[model samples]
Target: MQIIVVGIGGVGGYFGGRLALTDHRVEFVARGTHGKAIRENGLEVKSIDGDFRAFPYKVHETLDTIDAPDLVLVCTKSWQLEEVAQQLAGRIKSNTLVLPLQNGVESVEKLTGHLDPGQVLGGLCKVISKIDGPGIIDHFAFHPQVIFGEVNGERTERAIALEGVFRSAGIDVILSDDIQLAVWRKFLFICMISGMGAITRQEIGVMRADEHIRALMETSGKEILELAKHKGVGLTEKDLENAFRAIDAQKYHSTASVQRDLMAGRPSELHDFNGYVVREAEKYGVEVPVNAFIYYCLRPMEAKSRAHE
Candidate 1:
């Protein structure tokens, strides 16, 4: 299948590069310096799995420059979802599938509302990757997974074919029948980490070590889980426990990129991740005190970051 990867940031660059390396018909949609770099030197991925490069890969700056694709991976940050969706409409065919591989749960809703619901496939990516520099994607984890499903939960030809494409490239593909739950589980894990890390200006090592911070993290997770349950999400008590334990077992010593962006005075995705959770928690009358505090504390930092941006 012909694929177009939008927003060639960490997620788009790495996965698209892998598909291209394996001789898949993958085209990258990028802009400015990143686009120039990929065109001049190809896309480079540095990962524990292996380091390799794909040369002469198709790269374009706009939809007009390319043909309609079988799959369009919308990997932009949540804040850019609407704008990207508008541009995507110009290129996507009636049957073109959109897989949103961002950090939040709202992408699917936003994209599907703008485009055809059937054309938008629910997707979630679990990986720690970044664009270290122009044309270079650095992946810190060994496991890179991508999951997607039909909106109606029916197994379709494109859904299965997309899975085959990724698997042929050796990706950890989870073709979920219940993708919404997977997206929520990922949001629950990420929001807590980003919220706590941003407010405290600490990495996972220091944050998890402090009892007060650790408690806050756990509480925030519980608050979100409760909200999910209220919305009739099928998450078990064991699922909640396992989510917490997975973080503990990782022995992580890290902070989210949003925290780093806040500190560096660059616009962060806190509004979409942490801020979104806080807003949702309030509607449910679920008091997420810890998360609420984190949102308020980071307000000034986000303001400062936006001024510079």
Candidate 2:
């Protein structure tokens, strides 16, 4: 399969580099120093599993050099969706399948505005990773899973074909039947962990260890579940329990990526995570105090980020 990874950052870089190293025809789309490094020195991934470098692959800043790929992985940050849509509008063929490995629900719709709905798929990537430097992806986790499904919720040939490609490349892929619910449940988990961790500047281990923070996490999760119910997303009691159970099982060692980004003074998915909950809460006439508080508190940090810039 000819794959084009549209963002060579943490999630994209690590997965794309791994596929390329496995001798798949992977093209990485990057920019600035990272793009230059991949073009010159190759793409490198440093992970707990081990480290590997892939030098025999293509890297470019744009799609101008490549033809329409069979599959396009939209791995860019949620904020970059608009520009990515515009770029992909001309690059992707009608048959091209675009899988958005973005955080929020809005990405699929946003990209659908630019492409056919049949061509866009929902994808969620579970990994603790980030870019350490140019051409280098720093991953801290061993278990990396990519969950995805067709938008229409059927077992389509495109979905299966893509799954086959990913599986051949040695990836843990789950073809979900209820991807929307899966997305929301994942969002609930992220909102709880990211909001609390960003607000308190604490890791999951620290947060769970503290009784106060643990309660906050649980409350924030409940708020999300409530909001999901209000929105008629069809979330189940099992969904709520399963999410909490996963958190409990993790022993709180699993931290939010947003928390790590905020601590490092990097850009976070704050708006998409906590801010999304607050916005949706207002729409449903639901009060999400914990999420609202986290949104307001970390908002000022955006200014801090600008000042540094």
Candidate 3:
């Protein structure tokens, strides 16, 4: 398969690095020092799965100068999704598939706004990773996996073929029957935890262990659930419990990249996660005290961080 990985951050770097290990044509789109490092020394991955180097890999600074690819992995942060999708609009073959592995529920909705709806897949990835240095990726925790499917729940040939491609790289993958629901499930978990992490400025274990902090997380999660309900997304009590289960299973020091970015005075997916709920809640006439508080509290930091960029 001719694959184009648009971002070489933790999510893309690990998955794209794995694909690079295959016979498949895996090209990368990276920038600045990181792009130069990969171009000069190849991409290095330090993983619990075992360290490996994928050299002789193609790295592009932009999507220009490339022919149509079989698949385009939209690996940019949630806040960059729209701009990336716009760049991809009408640039790929009609049959090409675009999958978003970001931690959000509106990936497909956002992508379809710019590209052919049929060409976009509802997707999400489960992995704990980050860039350790220029041209280097660190897979620190979690058994990585990609789950995706047609937005309408069909077992399409393309979705199956993509799963096979991931498996060929020894990457765990799933083809969901209801991908929209799957994305919402993941969002439900990510937004709650990430919001709490930012609000408390604490790690997962610390927040989970503190009674008041844990309750705050639950309250914020319920707000998200209410907003999802109004948006026609089915989120049940069982799903909330399942989200907490995953949170509990995390290593104590765990923190989402969004939190890490904010802590380091870098721009993050603040609007895409908690702020998204606040806006939608107003649209749906639902109250979201917890999520609103989190979003407003972090807005100044997020703005100041972006100003530096």
Candidate 4:
């Protein structure tokens, strides 16, 4: 299959590198130093499961250089989704399957707003990874896996075929029956810890160990649950329980990409994570005081980062 991976950052670099290891024709879209490094030295993944390198068949900064792809993985930060979607609209064919592996629940909506809805799929991934260098990705923790399915939850032929492709590359993948719920389940955990982690400038273990911080985290999670329920996402109490369990299972020093970005003064997913929840809560008449507070407190820093960018 002709595959295109947009934004070859942590998630993209690792997953796209895995796919590139296969015989499939995988193309990468990246920019600046990272793009140049990948083009020259190949993409490298330092994974706990095992280290591997994938020299993509092609690499480009824009979609114009490539042919229409059968699959496109949107791995940019949540805020960049719209821009990437606009770029993909002209490059993808009718049968292209676009899977967004970013955080938050609005990726599918963002893509469909710009591209054909039929080409979009609900997707999320589980992995603690980041770019260790220009062309190197460090997969430090977790069993890396991709979960994806049609937005409406049908097991289509394309979904099945894609699953086979991932498995053939020796990557773990799940073909979710309820991808929306799966996305929300991941969102609930990420939103609960990420904003607070940024605010506290601490890791998951530190936040979970403190009683006051733990209380704040619980309240933040409840707010997300309320918002998800308002949106009719079918996130249940069991899901909420499982979210906390996932948080507890994380490595002591584990910090979300959003938290790390904020600490490093880089543009972050604050608007996509806490800000999205606050906006949606206001629209649905739900109260999210904790989320609102975190988002407001971090707005100044976020603005400063973006201003410099």
lDDT of each: 0.82, 0.81, 0.90, 0.92
lDDT string for model 3 (25-44, tens) is 98999999998999999999
Per-candidate clashes come to: 1, 0, 0, 0
Evaluated against the true structure, the overall lDDT of model 4 is 0.92
lDDT (Cα, tens digit) per residue for candidate 2, span 1-309: 788998988899877877786656888888899999999999888988788887636887886776788888888877678788877887878898899888786788888888888888888888778889988898876478899998779998889888988887677899988788878877876777786888888667787778988888888888888888887787776776777776665645666778877787877788888888899889889999988998999988855764785
Per-residue CA lDDT of model 4 for 180-275, tens digit only, reads 999989999999999999999999999999999999888988888888888998887788789889999999999999899989999999999999
Measured by lDDT, the strongest candidate is 4
Tens digits of per-residue lDDT for model 1 on 1-309? 788888888788778877887766888888888889989999888887888887635889876777888888888888788888877876778988889998888898888667988789888887778888999889876378898898678788878988999999888898889988888888887887887887878777787779988888888888787878878887666666776665665546656778877877878888888788789888888777877888888978888877776
Please provide TM-scores, in order, for all candidate models, with all chains considered together.
0.95, 0.92, 0.98, 0.98
Clashing pairs in 1: 204-254
Model 4 steric clash pairs: none
Residue 265, candidate 2: Cα error in Å is 2.9
TM-score order, best first, reads 4, 3, 1, 2
TM-score-best of 1 and 3? 3
Question: Model 4 has how many clashing residue pairs?
Answer: 0
